[model samples]
Target: MKVRNDAYLKAFGENLKQLMAKSNKNAETVAALGGIETKQVYRVINGEHSATLSIVYAIAKGLEVHPKELFDFTFQE
Candidate 1:
């Protein structure tokens, strides 16, 4: 299925990518830590889907950062 793209999603995805790079981590690793499927991580990273609150917390845990960090990006909506 094709997921819709929005400014919020795009910003979140970009931040996720940046965090992944800075942490020297991959989708597989994050997924394992977050207890989610690798594809899910990719979906968020690719800006193809929006993550739920739980997923956001999980991703934050995987990234070893606070949940607020993930949302520390500019968005208009």
Candidate 2:
């Protein structure tokens, strides 16, 4: 089956990448801070797959931001 990431997921990924860029940290660094795998961070950032709610929260926690902030996206997807 051919499946694609949902619009909201894609939007979240874009927002995550932007936040990561603004954090001035490398993927490895963010992954460590996010308590996730480095490859997973890249996968999410690259939109290879949809991120789970847990991941969303984890990422926000890693960034020292509120989960609501992650949802503050332009929703481009």
Candidate 2's clash total is 0
* Residue-level lDDT tens digits of model 2 in 2-57: 23346666677788878878877677877788798888877777777677888777
Please write out the lDDT profile of model 1 over residues 1-77, one tens digit for every residue.
22334777888999999999999999999989989888989999988878999989889889899999998888666
Q: What is the alpha-carbon RMSD of candidate 2 to the true structure?
A: 2.8
If scored against the real structure, what TM-score would every candidate get? 0.86, 0.75
Per-model lDDT: 0.88, 0.74
Winning model by TM-score: 1
Candidate 1 has a TM-score of: 0.86
Best prediction by lDDT: 1
For candidate 1, the lDDT comes to: 0.88
Candidate 1: which stretches are off by over 4 Å?
Answer: 1-5
